[model samples]
Target: MGKHIKTIARPALQSTIKGCGCGECQTSCQSACKTSITVSNQVCLKESKQHR
Candidate 1:
């Protein structure tokens, strides 16, 4: 019997942005990472700033 293995789907991030910005999921920037321990900045600063 084969061991159960679930593959996690990585978010589609832009080359310009690098990471997905969701600290819980994909790897993000230190300045923008939003975790329980620390909240230095926003989740998606690049996208928000770009749209605005």
Candidate 2:
């Protein structure tokens, strides 16, 4: 027997990148970038503010 693997759909990948969410949400142009690639949550272009 084989283990089942969960997966996200391709049509979902067809969606766009919204924001980096690093607290630099000043402008639409600043917060967004056109991407033909997928971004990993493990990496951030900017540091986020404290959650307090």
Candidate 3:
């Protein structure tokens, strides 16, 4: 019989900042910005499957 594997999504160690033009919060900081900035540190997940 063949075993069935389950897939799962999980955050990886490597991540990047989103909406930050300079990659670093210099003049326009999302947290301190008056206007709504969808700036956030995004973590990418790998497509992996697990065996149960």
TM-score of each: 0.24, 0.16, 0.17
* lDDT of every model, 2 decimals: 0.49, 0.40, 0.38
lDDT tens readout by residue for model 2, 1-52? 2268555543543333564445553332323454323334333335334332
lDDT of 2 at 1: 25
Candidate 1 lDDT over residue span 4-38, tens digit each:
86656555535635555444433434543444443
Ranking by lDDT: 1, 2, 3
How do all the candidates rank in terms of TM-score, highest first?
1, 3, 2
Q: For model 3, how does the per-residue alpha-carbon lDDT over 1-52 read when each residue is reduced to its tens digit?
A: 2268555756643553443234333233466446534443432122121221
Instruction: Please report the TM-score between candidate 3 and the true structure.
Output: 0.17
Model 2 stretches with alpha carbons more than 4 Å out: 7-24, 30-47
User: Deviation in angstroms for 45 in model 2?
Assistant: 12
Candidate 3, superposed: residue stretches over 4 Å from native? 1-9, 13-28, 31-33, 41-52
Candidate 3: 10-residue stretch with minimal lDDT: 43-52
What lDDT would candidate 1 get against the real structure?
0.49
Which pairs clash (backbone N, Cα, C closer than 3 Å) in model 2?
none
